[model samples]
Target: MRGSSGVAATFWSFLSISSSVLALEQQPFQFEAMSVPTYTLPPLPYAYDALEPHISAQIMELHHGKHHQTYITNLNAALKSQAEAVHAADITTQVALQQGIKFNAGGHINHSLFWQNLAPASSVDAKSSAAPKLLKQIQATWGDEAKFKEAFNAALLGIQGSGWGWLIKVETGKEQRLAIVTTKDQDPVVGKGEVPIFGVDMWEHAYYLQYLNGKAAYVQNIWNVINWKTAEERFLGTRADAFKVLKASI
Candidate 1:
């Protein structure tokens, strides 16, 4: 299996190429070589105060601007430092940078996705609230939506310390299933080959400003801002991609 640093390098390389292509395409006739792309903190889809009572503006600012930016910065530094070692096939240097790369890359990936996972309660339409397809899958897997929420919350509450609670889609042979899993620190769910359709950060920094020590309250209230529409889109898109891959393989 590829180590964390390898994964981080591959992910950033793809991002770099895509960005370079877009930059070149935007220009009329200027020919300029694209430099290596540095990972950046993606802007939140909504305003800082959008989540409001459920997630305070102060928390959003600190979480997105400060915390997430730190990860992006560190990730870029780690990748840059290890680039030559990685190209030289030096496993020792790669291993030494693995943890830092994983932590920062995972933080960047998770926080980027987390921002999209939320929306103002009012802005979420009835269709988003319904999540008909996801609801059926939830019902089939966990009996009902309420039961799924209960189980998911229980999983979040069970975290011994800083971690994340993720609702992921996994494929087993011909069958696709939904699973609730947790990852410690900033580790991402995608590392396990599962697509994270929804995730809630269980770290204190995510809620300490507003809920204090009440992790349960934070977890419960986060449901109010969850973008079910985004979750459904991820779920269905992953499934569709997997199907296309399977067909191509055949």
Candidate 2:
């Protein structure tokens, strides 16, 4: 009887250990490096106050440091979850995470471009003359700079809610055209053959603190700090060149 009892106890202990090993194997395996953040915020290309008078220092501080960083943080979290989902082959969780990834990724991409699209109001790069080739293209499309500004500002004001206004260079085979386009919420300007030459953030956080409810004034004054040099480069460069800002962040 004693021998039979000892054998039964050993069998049960072995089964328990085997079950624990199997359970550990079934859990998603994560590398130590996976715990580290996959994405980080890029430094502002210029000082927070550089676009002052047109865009306030306080707004820049909050928008770039707080708002933009939140997007990065959320995006990293979503991606980490996605990696685990992929490892576990959890299709349902992967699908649910798509919207989070999209929104946060778009926010990062748009803001990366936004910072480069601005310069000090007093800098020569902020002047329209800094973009002669782009100016010619704009003139051909909108008759002249003034008319283009009018059309662009109208697009900015026409946005029903939080969004963005863009001056995009569209290419069709051998031909190219410049168009004023708007993207709703955190959606990016990502159509094929489209290169975003410059973008104006229409989200209230972009202008609300300084301008109060005067959104039109914010639209009108943003041009004062528009980085024409960067616009010209994006206009002349390929779509890949335009998105290099995003790659650099990674």
Candidate 3:
């Protein structure tokens, strides 16, 4: 067990040093009254080597530690002064901080979904039972799961550059309506008043190394591990008052 797979060691290095935010973690916040939860990447419940073949070990390590953690680090820093500025009623200060929070926070949230959205492609069973209720919703709304997958994959692949493809629930008439949304960069789905049930990461770093130039192959493989159960929970379950979803136990 002690043979240094270079996997665990590299992961720690990426988390502790390579990540942008972890370094700033020591810088104490000047104001403590800010009502924002400091954004951070939740530790994945599985191992780096878990999602291979379809996605390489190198990509997972970099995506989780360096890319995801950086978002959390930057978001926390942005929130540090927000409390003081808001308390003092400084219009300009509060306004300026909005863009930073949205971008970095979006990065944090989107990455979280990105991680959850993937699994070892091997786990995919094309004939698995689809929850009756979930299936009914899909057929009525998007014709069928196959069609939905096609649309989802197409949208995700179409993102001009770094961003996300989302299956969101929009509010209308008294119930949440199902809709597909493509968020550019790290923008939050909630900001646009859509509740994101599932999301696909389309960033170059998300697939470039593993798939190389094979974008369609990457997209096809992602659906194999789509966490249908989690998607149901996000859709039917309740989320926190302000941007909080009780961490889904893996």
Highest lDDT model number: 2
- Best to worst by lDDT, what's the order? 2, 1, 3
Provide the RMSD of all predictions against the true structure, rounded to 1 decimal.
Answer: 8.6, 17.4, 10.8
Residue-level lDDT for 127 in candidate 1: 35
lDDT of 1 by residue, 1-250 (tens): 1235545544655575576568757863442332334776677888999999999999999999999899988988998767657556788999999999999988987887788778887875313454668788899999988899999999999999899999998866557788999999999866444778888999999999999999889988999899888787667655333222112211
Q: Measured by TM-score, how close is model 2 to the native structure?
A: 0.85
Q: Name the lDDT value of residue 74 in candidate 3.
A: 86
Candidate 3 local lDDT, 78-192, one digit each (tens): 8877766876788799999999989987888777765655555555422224334555677789898889888888888788877888887665545766788898888878744
Indicate whether candidate 1 or candidate 2 has the larger TM-score: 2
| Candidate 1 structure, TM-score to reference | 0.81
Best by TM-score: 2
Model 2: per-residue Cα lDDT at residue 30 = 46
Between prediction 2 and prediction 3, the one with superior lDDT is: 2
List the global CA lDDT of all models.
0.78, 0.87, 0.68
What's model 1's overall lDDT?
Answer: 0.78
Angstrom error at residue 36, model 3:
6.8
- Minimal lDDT window, size 10, model 3: 241-250
